[model samples]
Target: VKRIIALPGEHVAIRNGAVYINGQRLIEPYLSEPTLWRGMTLDHEYVVEPGHVFVMGDNRNNSSDSRVFGAVPLSSIVGKAWVTYWPPDEVQVLTTPAYAFQ
Candidate 1:
């Protein structure tokens, strides 16, 4: 699963291992490490289409998400993340994070 980093019409960029949306650095408290990989759309400033959103994996270093595939069409998203069952110890219901853009 991936986190939606940019909304429709928003500009996204990756620099110095951080994500910027519309020129504002995104505050991501859930990331275990900084994003170290780059991809086609995220390599430089990219504008999200009106019907698309930019997504990224929590484990940025190893995930092959929007960084590789580009912004995902909103209609293409089939399901929401419901729970985390892997590793047993961390199993729990998932909730959408609230983001405050400055």
Candidate 2:
């Protein structure tokens, strides 16, 4: 699963171990560590299409998401992830994070 990083018509870029939206650094309080990985999109800036969204894995340094496949069409998303069951002790219902674009 992936987190929607950039909404339609938004610009996303990654540099210096952080994700930036438009020209402002994105405030990601849920991330366990700084995003230091680079992939197809991380090396440059990209704009999400009108019906698409940019997605990234929570495990930034080890995920293959929009950074590798480009933006995903909204229609392609079938469901919202509401629970995480892995790692046993860390499992719980997921809550939507209030993103603060810095």
Candidate 3:
């Protein structure tokens, strides 16, 4: 799944299938083109509310997330997803993107 690379109050957008934040393109080396945004419901015009998170899946086309159900309140985020314990090949510690904190 994709991570919460950016948070509330951050401007986010998808253009030509690439993600950008605050007027800068995000360096999502993990993703390739054809990253489908099939089920996304969060239009770029919507502002992420304070204390809420906007999340999407790595497999963009198939995800059911904030883009569909709207931003997730920070209170609803029970904990951070620290590791991928399942799928041996995908297991690793999660690193929040640096731009996410800007």
* Candidate 2: stretches off by over 4 Å: 40-43
lDDT of 1 by residue, 1-94 (tens): 8888889999988877888899898888888788764644346788899999999889899998877888899999888898999989999998
**lDDT of candidate 3 over 1-102, digit per residue (tens):** 447856889776666666667767677766655444455533454467899877878777777876677778888876767787779887899787555311
lDDT of the structure predicted as candidate 3: 0.67
Give the lowest summed-lDDT range of ten residues in model 1: 35-44
lDDT of each: 0.84, 0.86, 0.67
lDDT of 2 by residue, 42-80 (tens): 468888999999999999889988887889999999889
Collision count for each candidate, in order: 0, 0, 2
State each model's C-alpha RMSD to the native: 2.0, 1.8, 3.4
Order of quality (TM-score): 2, 1, 3
Q: Candidate 1 regions off by >4 Å?
A: 37-43
